[model samples]
Target: MRLFIAEKPSLGRAIADVLPKPLRKADGYIVAANGDTVSWCIGHLLEQVEPEVYDPAFKKWSHEHLPIIPDRWQLVAKRKTSKQLAVLRKLVKQADQLIHAGDPDREGQLLVDEVINFLGVSKEKTAAVQRCLISDLNAKAVKQAVSKLRSNQEFIPLSTSALARSRADWLYGINLTRAYTLQGQKAGYNGVLSVGRVQTPVLGLVVRRDQAIESFISQPFYEVWAQLETLPEDGPVERFQAKWQPSKQCQPYLDEAGRNSSKPLAENVIKRISHQPATVMQLARQHKKQAAPLPFNLSALQIEASKAFGLSAQQVLDVCQGLYERHKLITYPRSDCRYLPKDHFTEAKLVVAAITFNSGASKAATSLFGTNSEAFKSVDIGVKSRAWNDAKVNAHHAIIPTQKKLNAAKLTSTLSAIEEKVYRLICRNYLAQFLPAYEFFDVKAEISIGTGIFLAKAKEPIKVGWKCLFPSAKPKAEADNTDQESEQKIPNLHIQQGLKSLAARLDEKHTSPPKHYTDASLLAAMTGISAHVSDSELKKVLRDTDGLGTDATRAGIIELLFKRGYLRRQGKTIFSTKTGRAFVDALPDVATHPDLTALWESRLTAIHDGLSSYQELMMPLQTQLKSMVVDSRSVVPHGLRGLGSKAQYRKKQYRKKRPRKSKSSAKV
Candidate 1:
């Protein structure tokens, strides 16, 4: 009998749907009439055993048990999923051939592989097992994937990378958490001070940002603008604004950013330029083109969703999962790559149609797509943008809408408000690829009033092609339309052309401190962190890699920080708690910076690419854990002052559940 093991029930059902008909649903496995069986693991049926399982002595948290390294790692069935594991064990023994179906990512690879190893399948059957990688749950995609199965041994390196990462996190988190909590107890703060590989660095970012904002000192700066009028060859004279530039002679009186510090110097420039004859010394004008925005990976989607709808990172990932698995509206949602395979370019027409047909015009009419969805119809479906580069596509393509024919009537009933919004966002980017490039003319003028130079910039629109699709710019993107240059319309002028200078406009401004970390910016910082490293090559590698953790895990790490009282949210802004700041201050530098996380991420990627081994990654991490464990005991920890004063306040992470009304209350 052929057997299929999927990552989850939904995926199992999806696989079973495409199999031969006359299927019988067993307790935990599906039996096809053709003697094929399909079963699933609930997330992970087997998990790493806790430290206590290694030895009874390790059950109690003690400094002596610091750096608790198990001689051999072991896996046991989770209590909640023990039944599922039993089902798999029975099915695995009966099957003649096996197919491993897991999500096409690192975690997915490891979860299914570990299950097979734990099931004690024979070496011959394991070596010959077929691997099924499914990124989309639609019947057509799944059927196509099943037809082209590969040997599971090909992905052993990927599984090894994940195994190394899991064990490394365990060694670091379990050891350091025990060590630090002990120190905190001695400091009068009786809270369990958890330290994680990813969570601590993220908390450090917030705490350090808060500190910088507190210490910043605002300084007054001065600027001079020339209200110059153009002398056109014909028609009415047009006026435009230009700003004065600091000359090399004014270096002493100007700040490093070239903002004038002397009020008297600014007054002189204002007097000199007002009503003076100005000559256009330099003129530059050329058309520029901007391509459509790329489709989102998980991180990009989370960041944009946070900025647009104030949704938390975890909220966005949850909604994405619903859209992918439940509704089948999108492809994979946990992908880190933003580029699409060149082969997928052919499906543009159908994807656009699916989104347009499923507009949910009546009940779910959105401001983005509206009832008509006319924007998609006009998308010239042949214009393949740079987003279709095959070289950049990795693991999975960008998160995208599937070619599944969506039912408009059922969409409103099946999807929530946020799910609909996120679905439309994915569709919009996919449709944008078929639109033309945004073309504009960048016009600049360099005006001179004696020795002082003034400059003006304006952009003239040539074609509002792709820009029509996006009315407003997403935060921190290249499409920010809020700038003055994009709005300004420059009049006709030539070099050496004479112009009349109007009254000068001078405005004083103060340098402001950096803004607090919001949910959006913090997530952005995690995936694309500016690693503070001196090695040029390693720094570039870190910047290129997924920053602190995988896209699938970053949201969880942020959520963990909040649940542990290490971070708090006020409106959209995130701040480190007093306990959080104090904890960071007490720890060693390596424990609080992105450098360590960056190094680990690069090494893991090397393992995935077949350049490194599991030992290469874990050996150093194990050594580092030993050193940190020693420091935890050797160094004197200063407790969080006044932390236990109202210990209950920090302990109240979750609200109590309200009791249901009694029968008497219901009668009333």
Candidate 2:
């Protein structure tokens, strides 16, 4: 009997629904008429041991159990998920061959491997272990994946990397959590302090941002604005605003006290520009082009959904996962790449048609791309480029709509706002690639007010082009048929010849502080910026690197920060706690640095590429962790100040000193 194991029950059930044959249900396993069984693990059935596993007594929190390290790392059945483990064990014992149908990612790989290792299935009992790697869970894709499963042994290094990561997280989480909690308790604090590798660094980000905000001393900066009213060659009066040159420099003036003094630049600039009627000096017009955007990855989807639908990062991932695993309308959920595979072009039409049947954009796309049939093949298919490199794709390509005819009925009640956003993001990107570039004429007019120069700018799009895919970019104004025209349909005019000044007004404005980071903004910051260390090589290595964490792990890392009280959400704003602030302040420069994450990621990639051994890659981390801890402890912890009053705060480090052998040795 062949047993197929999916990542979760929902995915297993979805896969089972499409299989060839009469399927019978066993205890947590589905048996097909063709003597094949399908089962699934509910996420991870087992995880690395907690500190208590070393010694039963260590289960209770104490400083004595400071740095718990076990000789052999053990896997413990997740307390709440042990029932699933039992199901897996029973199915594995009875099966002739096992199919690993986990999600196609590191976390999924690790989850399945841990379950298999825990089952103790020997090579003698199993004929073969096959991997059913799949991006889309549609009927055809699922069937194709099952029919062509590869050996489990082929993904050994991937599984090893996952296992290593899990082990590392456990080691850090357990030891650091215990160390912080016990130390806090010893200092007379009653709260349990939790820390982890990802969570700590994640928290540090929020803390640092909050610190920057709190300490930000706003320097009052000013700008001068001159508003001008102009009669266009073919339209009604239009008002435009221009700012003074040397925006920061001001003309000095007398104070209200009748004493001559250099007044604020804003007042001076506004005063100087108000006395003149703006004159038409120069106008230049040129065509500008904007290309279509790429498709959605997990991170990109989350960002767009957050902005469009105001969904959380976790919410976006959940919706996308549901669409992929349950509805089977999209491909994989946890992907970082944004380019579709070459072969996906054939499937692209089906996806486009499916979405078209339901939305106006479908008709628009069909018109723009010459129907689904003529659309895809006409474009660059199988064009191997850096962006579309197949070698960069791991288990799955970027998230995209699948070829399966999306059940209109299924999408009706099941579609969430976020899911709708995801669908639109995919559909828009797919349609955009084939569409023409946005054509616009940038009109720049320079007007002179006496010696002062002013500028007025406007954009006239010759064609909506790819920009039509974006709902915001579509033209909303009606066409101008009358001799009187709107900015939307206005024609080109010579500056000095056609220009007529109607009125002039001076406007003043003040600059504000930078906007706070939203979920979308923060994700962009994590993935976009050059947050690397001072080392130029390290910066170069991290340049254009994906992000702080993989798409699968980023949400979890953010959640971890919240759970650790490092970050808290109020409305849509995330703020750092006092404890979080102090923690970041107390941490070594490297621990909280994004460069460290980048360096580790670079090394991990090296390990993945077989350029470095895992041991060698991890040696630096191990050394750093030890050294950081040692250095941290040696310092008089300033974090202690916020712990409470000094009397109960400072607990001298406990050392086990040898005692003088009492007369008990003599008696013996």
Candidate 3:
């Protein structure tokens, strides 16, 4: 018999659907008429053993065992899922050949491979063990993947990298958490000072942003604007707005740091340009084209969902997963690649047809490319676009609609409000790739009034194109320093024509502090942190590596911080708690900085590429653990120090407000 093991039951059923069916369903698995058995793991059947499982003495927290590095790592079946593991083990023993149908990633490779190890199956004993990599859960994609299975040995390096990462996290998180918690207990606080390789750095980002906002001091400045009317030969006088630009020597509104700080100089400029005749010195018009946005990667999707629907990062992930696994509406949801493989153009056409008349997307499709028009009938998804580059594709392509079509009424009735919204987001983005680029004309006019130069500008849309699909989507605002006149409509005027200034006024404005981070902006920061690093080599390495965590894990990491009481949410904005801020202050830069995690990721990449060994990476991490333990031993835990007084005050108030236990209860 041949056996197939999948990462999840939904995926296993998807695989089973594609094979020759008439499957016999069992308690935990299904066997096909062709003698192929299919089973699944909820996720991971086994996990690394806890500290107590290593040794009883190590269970008690002590500074002497500060850095607990196990001589030999161990794994045990998760108690809740052990029954399913038993079923898989029995099948493994009976089968002569095995097939691994896990997700196409390092963690996925480890998930199935670990089960094989647990069942004590060896390559010498089994006839053959093969690996199948499938990204989409659709029947066609699964069938194609099954026909091209490769040897499991080829993914051993990825498995090794995964193990190294798991062990490194365990060593760092377990030891550091215990050390900090113990220190806090000694200081009269009661709470676990939980830490992780990625969570601490994420917390640091929020705390620093909050500090910057609190410390900011606003400075006032001014700008002068003129309401002018053109001397026109055409209909009605062409009225427009213009902003005055001070000369280099006369400009004093900006301080040394280039921040707005002077109102007097602005007032002087207003005086000079007021009640003056202006001549149009230069008029220029330029045509521009903006291509459609790239398809959704996991991070980009999360950011967009957070902004559009006010959904949390975790909520977006959950919805996308449901669409991918349960509904079969979209492809793999945890992808990082924003581009599709060149050969996928054929597949793209199939997906486009599937969503052409979807629940909430039919109107967008019909409007962008008229329902019965030639453009709609001959929709060209193979237009040599930037979104179709093979070099940009990594392990999986971007999140796209699948070729599995469903009835419009069924879709609308089955999906929740958020799911419908997310599904449409994917559809519109994918459909946009086939439409013409959005076109516009930018007009700029410079007027001369005495020694001052006034500027007027406007944008005129030539063609809506892909933008017509999203009527509700707003254009991103220009930078703060951008000329306000550029955002206004400019009346038609000839060069060298004279115009009269009706009114001139100086408007005072103050420098605003940085905005608080919402889930949207935080995800952007986490994924783009490498761009802020000073070291060129480290930045390059980090760019190649996932910035903080894998797409599969970043949302969970953020969610964990909230559960641990290190982060608090107000409306859509996220702020670090007092405990979180003090925790960052107490830790050394080595522990809190993102650079350390980036370095580890770089090493993990090296291991993946066969340039370095897993043991090589582990040795350095173990050494760092020892040094961190020693350094942390002398440090005091001040995270909860500030909260001590608040705790005491609350306790006192509770005692005073407490009603004495009723005499009736005592008698009972």
Report residue 407 deviation for candidate 1 (angstroms): 4.8
Please report the candidate that would top TM-score against the real structure: 1
List residue ranges in candidate 3 displaced over 4 A: 123-128, 153-157, 226-253, 256-259, 277-285, 360-379, 382-384, 442-449, 453-457, 472-484, 489-502, 531-537, 602-617, 642-668
lDDT (Cα atoms) of all candidates against the true structure: 0.82, 0.63, 0.77
lDDT by residue for model 2 (1-668), tens: 77788998877976787776788887777777787778898887765554554566766765455455555556667667778777888878888888888998878877887677667777554336788888887778777777778887777667666655665566566666556555555445445455566566666666667767777765434444466655554477665555444422223442333222332544555566664556667778888887767777888888877786677788888888788776777888898777766666666556666655544434334433343433333344233323355666766677877775544444545676456556756765765666677788877667676566655566777987666556442344543211111243323456564333433433332324556667787776666545635567777776475357678887777766666556778877778766677666655666676767666666655655556565664556666656555554433334644453334222221112222221111000
Top candidate, metric lDDT: 1
Instruction: Select the stronger candidate by TM-score from 1 and 2.
Output: 1
Clashing pairs in 1: none
RMSD of each predicted structure: 7.2, 9.1, 8.5
Residue 149 shift from truth in candidate 1, angstroms: 1.4
Q: How close is candidate 2 to the true structure, as a TM-score?
A: 0.76
TM-score of 1: 0.92
Candidate 3's residue-wise lDDT over 1-668, tens digit each?
Answer: 87889999999898888777698889889889898889999899887766766565766778887789887677777667989998998988998889988887778888888888767786585336898888888889889888988888777787787778888888988898878767777666566677788888889888888999999998786667777887655557878787776667753556655533567777676777777888899999889999989889888999988998888899999999999998888988987778888878877778888877564344433443344334444346756568999877745688899887776676777888789788878876888888788898899899888788888878778887676655544444643435445556777777898888776777777878988889999888878878545567888767544577777778998998887778999999999988888888878887787877877877776776677788888888889989988888788866576343333223221122223221111000
- Per-residue accuracy of model 1 over 133-210 as CA lDDT, tens digit each: 788889988888788899999898888888988888888888898898778778777666778898888888899999
TM-score of 3: 0.86
